[model samples]
Target: MKEYSVVPNKDVTGWMVKIEDVAPEKLYDERDAAIAEAEEIAQKNKPSRVIIMDQNHEVEEERTY
Candidate 1:
């Protein structure tokens, strides 16, 4: 199974969608955008899940595909 995570950027000024332990290639200005992109990716790649993290870097919610 694949896993995606929406987490705040290193500077905490933006959000990023990371696949597994790979580094995020893009940063989203909004958390919602990041989540949306993550969900879309998860949908494309079935048998995957999305892990949403809050600003505090804690898991806020999870969605399985």
Candidate 2:
């Protein structure tokens, strides 16, 4: 199954949507927007999962489609 994660940037200034097997990465200015984008992709690729990480890089939440 495919997977995606929304993680905080190293500087903690932004959020990143990390999609498995997809490079370059997707950055977002807002946390909500990043999560929304991740959800969109998760919905598109059903049977996948979306992981949300906290600023400390720990898993905060997860959702499966």
* Candidate 2 wrong stretches, greater than 4 Å: 21-24
For residues 1-65, write the lDDT of model 2, one tens digit per residue: 88999998889899999988365278888999999999999999899999999999899999999
Best by lDDT: 1
Local accuracy of candidate 1 as per-residue lDDT tens digits, 23-65: 8957999999999999999999999999999999999999999
- The whole-model lDDT of each prediction reads 0.93, 0.89
Lowest lDDT 10-mer window, candidate 1?
Answer: 18-27
Where is model 1 more than 4 Å wrong at Cα?
Answer: none
